[model samples]
Target chain A: MEPAVKKGPADILYDEVWELARTIVDARKQIGALRPSKLKTKNVSAALLEMDEIVKATEEASNTIMDSAEIMSSADASDAGYSALVQENCSKIFEACVFQDLTGQRISKVMTTLELVDTHLQDLQDLLGPEFDEPDDGVDEREGDEALLNGPALTDEAISQDDIDALFD
Target chain B: MTANKKDMSILIVDDYKTMLRIIRNLLNEVGFKNIDEAIDGVTALDSLRSKKYDLIISDWNMEPMTGLELLKTVRADATLTKLPFIMVTAESKTENVVAAKQAGVNNYIVKPFNAATLRSKLTSVIGEF
Candidate 1:
């Protein structure tokens, strides 16, 4: 009888792929809870669009997982076969997870921003009666009722000016 | 400006703080003393736009921006396009490599990988070892 092949890069790649599949499944469930609150805004249309892109990316990543499993189970499991390619391929998929995580965070922050914007708009509607003439400078800092919304303002935070200038030049 | 131990930074973009910590520790173990973290792609893009990184190690399954989008964006940028990028993902499909290669990935690594695999990926991708 042939000796059992030792666990090599293919096995490593397979286990990694399986673990990632599990992570994706878990993330999908977690994201379902977040989708509703994120979609609840007009200003968040951009963020919502971003969310769509992320979801698609996640799906695409999930799809690739099947290939990982296939390659492992096939003749490719041997080091003499497609193990090198599998290792390389696995890294790329792993890379996608990095971006997915980023997208999720961006969505969360944007959702928070959207909520704040909604609260501010409501206060402005109540204060100026919703028909105030547009201020020439359009910079109104009206303090409203007891509904104190606390968080970082999006405008106040951004990449620095030096960085911008460097990128442009 | 001179590059110090603190200046040779690596940016890790992933939504999971736990994963971020894992990667950071691995990079530290691999002699990369300086590191930055981004929770998602948009923020990562912002960071990439703002500073020059020695390396970018990212996850593939984030929301609002996946690693591929970030890679595409990074590749689209003329100045920052050449920066070395390594994708650390759980997805191991063949199409993933095709897309990532098309998007200009430097190297890819699968998750649950050890310190050796991480180091090897970085070395193979950037040849900075």
Candidate 2:
């Protein structure tokens, strides 16, 4: 067989760069121009705010239920106007149950955020490819968490603020 | 001017608008009307500097600057150190509570609380409403 041509360091570096560019092009095709800042501010923050609302709704509803139960328990039904008391408390319960509707809507918003994040993550996976797994080799999990603190990324491969928080956390 | 607790202006800080609204309503139930709002610690700090407040009720997990950081900053400042602060948290974690207490938080309120709990926490800090 003919002697094979040896590649220099410069040639090897060019090949690696070309490979990265190809991977990015492919990922861009998959993600269709991901606006990372939007993901952090609008998507993530909105989802979190929505989830907060859900928590508030849940807590308010439970509190209402408990308050009514306690009121009903403390007051005797045998006493005059007991039926009126029960009617008022039951009406409050009906009002509190409306929280379910708000919670459902908030959950839907969170789901949408998760789905979008998954798609963005798919972009990252594609760009990183199989080589992403190699970095974990011989790395302690706790050390890996520290290693993840790759500060503000370059504009070409920017991570959202939430992504940085995830890395730090 | 006499500093009446009921009429004293209060500053409420929470990143979430709904939480601010809930706290505002509860504070109303507690019979305090002059209230202001801040979205995060930075804004709250600014408000503290520009205007005087009787008490501060701040949520723990705010962005940019957390409530713990805010507390530390407040305590560090001789002017703001004496400001009565009641922290609000969704978590009942001992470590967090210890940290807040160490940072000089006057009191803390766990989430899902009602008017009574709010009033109770408020009472401990600023005296009975």
Q: Give the per-residue Cα lDDT of candidate 2 at A155.
A: 55
Rounded to one decimal, what is candidate 2's iRMSD? 14.5
Error of 1 at A57 (Å): 27
Q: Could you give the DockQ of candidate 2?
A: 0.09
The Cα error of candidate 1 at residue A31, in Å, is: 31
- In model 1, which regions exceed 4 Å deviation? A1-169, B1-7
lDDT digits (tens) for residues A1-169 of candidate 1: 9998888999989999999999878766754545545555554677677778777766666556544544454534556747677776678668756766877787787778677667755554554453664546854465431111222224444323233223323
Q: Score the docking of each candidate (DockQ).
A: 0.03, 0.09
Interface RMSD of each: 18.1, 14.5
What tens digits encode model 2's per-residue C-alpha lDDT throughout B1-129?
116789988999999776787788778767888999999999999999999888889888777887888888999999988998988766444445556777888877766578887887777777865
